[model samples]
Target: MNLTSVDELFETDASREDKQREKVLDIPLSKISDFPNHPFKVKADEAMLEMADSVKQYGILVPGLVRTKADGGYEMVAGHRRKKASEIAGKESMPCIVRELNDDEAIVAMVDSNLQRESILPSEKALAYKMKLEAMKRQAGRPSKEDNYSQLGNNFSTKTSSDELAVQTGESKNQIFRYIRLTELIPPILEMVDEKQIAFNPAVEISYLTENEQTELLETMKQEENTPSLSQAQRLKKFSQEGRLSTDVIYSILTEEKPNQKEKFNIRRDRIDQYFPKNYNEKQKEDLIVQLLESWYKKRQREQER
Candidate 1:
């Protein structure tokens, strides 16, 4: 009978559970590097502090996933947050599940794991989707459309990668494409989208502008203290495509008052209270005022007709 070592037996058992053949290994924190272009942020916020406390009290309950690098170090595949927390907890080494994965496979796994987080920024999703889409296309051995997007013209029909991405991510095909469109936006504009300062539809339209045009638009927005409406953004995109967009043109479009952009009127509560009942609430006072205005307008119209 052949005697198997305990480590070997554990490895054999772990391999049987997964087709990928993952093995838990204690890796030094210094040897593990971050995944290139990892879209998810690892902030040392309250949650991270809590996780660090947990790690200090009980060690890392879950093992991180990592792959061997060409230079002999390990690249983190998942659990970046866990790694950071472990470092904070004064841990020299962390338990990791080692796996061999190619670039496309790693990208897919990394994206899938991070997407499960509760909160993801818009810019993070945009860049992550773009990376995964490119990886998927590469894996399929299909040439990317980005290299000759303008040369292929607007009538091209290559959405296989996007469709696959949509299926994987639970987003609509059109929405996936829209998020990918955000990759063309400059960082400042993209950050605005993440901050909710810019709406999604308008941001998509703005992404079509050339870099110079986008810079000018950013300046115009800052000067005017306003963001583009969907219609205005579309007009800017159309003008850019036509090669007629300029700083002056952007200024003109931005200066145009939108139909819904009405000036607000404010009234002091103390000033209006004398005109209403002492017991009347704010809503009652507003309704009574509106009724009186309607009656006054009707009386004036009747007099004018007489």
Candidate 2:
């Protein structure tokens, strides 16, 4: 019942077919317990109210989905608002389509339902993609090109049973791969991707970047207008390969494909350090401390501003 626990969300009990067809007739809302949404889509109050008005006027166009309760009540799946609106309208019994989905099925169903609205969070998409991939792996023992993922109990992978998930989803292999890459990005940038502040291709390009590089580009991205470019990605690769890339270079590559950036730090170990103790804090300690403090200050500043 808490959105913070992904484990709990994915571990819910599924619905059974016989239970789905058990014919729980016009169950009164009062009799059926209210199920609060952990990950709710209730933000658009005007919209929910509008939908409620529609439900009140013409009745629930799409039957609310529910699951059978052991105590002779029902738990909601989809259409929480419709159930709520119907109850608000003082209806004794509300129409519903009862289904019993397992934990995984429930997660998939909840994700799919949320996807119907304006936009789904990138974090949600990442989890959904991961769920499907795991489910596909379970079904076929691997991501084989032959099996139809759709036929499986849960098609969590981007593609159906067949390896043609790209075709089925109407996305390019690159795009699909890019979406999967979003899974690798840490939360903040992923949130940025969900906000539509960052475009898909550029974000994917950034995902391939290393943590340091990603952190670097993310800092630059805040000050700059658009996200990094393909050219920027390539440049980053080149710099990283050249073994001289810095946070500045990361920003430069992302913002301008220009090689105006230079490595910010260079460590030159003295030829005599071999005789010192491995655990010793030598004369270099003071300088190293200053550098560490500078980095910490910058990080703290970013955190505060954020």
- Give the alpha carbon lDDT tens digit for every residue of 110-157 in model 2: 545655666556655555555554554455556443332221223345
TM-scores for candidates 1 onward, in order? 0.74, 0.53
Residue-level lDDT for 28 in candidate 1: 98
**Model 2 residue-pair collision total:** 15
Per-candidate local distance difference test: 0.86, 0.61
Clash pairs, candidate 1, are none
Give me the displacement of residue 43 in model 2, in angstroms: 2.8
- Model 1 Cα shift for residue 290 (angstroms): 30
Q: Residue 291 of model 2: what lDDT?
A: 83
**Candidate with maximal lDDT:** 1
Every model's Cα RMSD, please?
Answer: 10.8, 16.5
Q: How close is candidate 2 to the true structure, as a TM-score?
A: 0.53
